[model samples]
Target: MAKTKKNVNEMSFLDHLEELRWHLIRAVIAVFIAAIAAFIAKGFIFDTLIFGPTKPTFFTYDILCSISQSLGLDDSFCFNEAAFEIQSRTMAGQFSAHMWTAITAGFIIAFPYVLYELWKFISPGLHPNERKHSRGFIIISSILFFLGVLFGYYVICPLSINFLGTYQVSDKVHNDFDLSSYISLIRSSVLACGLIFELPIIIYFLAKVGVITPEFLRKYRKFALIIVLVVSAIITPPDIASQVIVAIPVLILYEVSIFIARFVTKRQNSKALKNV
Candidate 1:
């Protein structure tokens, strides 16, 4: 006869670890498969997406230029051409960048699958009601992540590239960025924003576990604002406009997280009252 699977409560610690290992293995395999697909689409991934912000005709530039012109502002937002040149200084630089970029793209493409794997591992330990309440976790998180990625690519990346690429202290100095450096900027912006946009989901879990409450978030709203600004400054170019643009959505997310925490707390309280 086949061995029966043990319930989560009956499983030994090592068995739990083994279960986790399998989930992680499956997630990694999914990522690798996605990465392979990304590797095969090098032209679209690099020329059309990764290097898109560096072009003068990028969507972000054209929009910003149009807005600036309509508002009667200076031509600072308009770009005739990108001033900096990207070069591979080392023999393996281009190859290494290509490989890493593919991996990053793979992780992004397979994000929902990864979350599904993670949910499968954790759901077994949760009550049926808890699991039911969180049925939309993977979908909601994936949507937020993709939205953040789009925002970073269309707003932050172009702003940073335009500013840094054209800025020169003196006419004698020219900006010649390395291939890895340029890719790194794009990768970091996309991934960081994606993760940052998961703030509401993270807050929901913390509230469910009683680690935080809406009151706590409300109390620290000022500090959160400061932290958001600081984080915006770190991720974006050192300019007020870029920082403000990045900070707006994050601040909105923080407020939404507070509302979520409040809802979770109210549900928990009502459930407790019903059991009394």
Candidate 2:
């Protein structure tokens, strides 16, 4: 027989902690299984995916080159050859990179499961209506995260690699990047963008909790724009085109977040009035 779930109201603090521990354990196990798979696919993970952006024939490069040609702009984004070499300086550097990369991939692959575990932990505390309303939270969050990861991999990663890899302050300085450094850049970009794309979800929860209001978001619209531009500059290549491309999506997400926040606020007000 399956184990019955304990009622949240009847559970003590220790019981809550124990419940959380089990959820975390399950989530970790899922990640470990996924990571093992990633580790086993070393050739595909390393050669095809990790180092793909460094190659001139990368898909992003081809698309960007075509766009540039069609626009009659200089082929600044297109390159004939890779401009940098990656090397492992430490004796165990390759092994370490492979291990950590696998773990990162595992976490990403198992993100939906992790979210499910998280939702299971918290759902007991929410009202039945709230739980029903948020039935698609895991799916929506997973979709947003995957979209962000793709945007990072296909757009931000290639632009940064093309610019930074090809940049030459002096001919004397050769761009021989370390393996760890290269992997770190790709990992950070992919993960950072993935989290950043959860803006609307974050706003919805904040509004639900009365922590933030839609008017507050609108009042700080100018500040948010400046912050978005700054973040775009930080993430993308230091070029206007790259920055604009990044900023536009983020701006759109922000607007969507505002709409979500407003909807949440209106619903909360309606609930309050009904209760009265």
TM-score of 1: 0.96
Find the number of clashing residue pairs for candidate 1: 0
Instruction: Give the TM-score of each candidate.
Output: 0.96, 0.96
**Could you tell me the lDDT of residue 82 within candidate 2?**
86
Give Cα-based local distance difference scores for all models.
0.91, 0.92
Best by lDDT: 2
Worst 10-residue lDDT window for candidate 2 reads: 1-10
Q: In model 2, which regions exceed 4 Å deviation?
A: 1-4
Which ranges of candidate 1 are over 4 A from the true structure?
Answer: 1-4
Kindly give the stretch of ten consecutive residues in candidate 1 with the minimal lDDT sum. Answer: 1-10
Report how far residue 273 has shifted in candidate 1, in Å.
Answer: 0.6
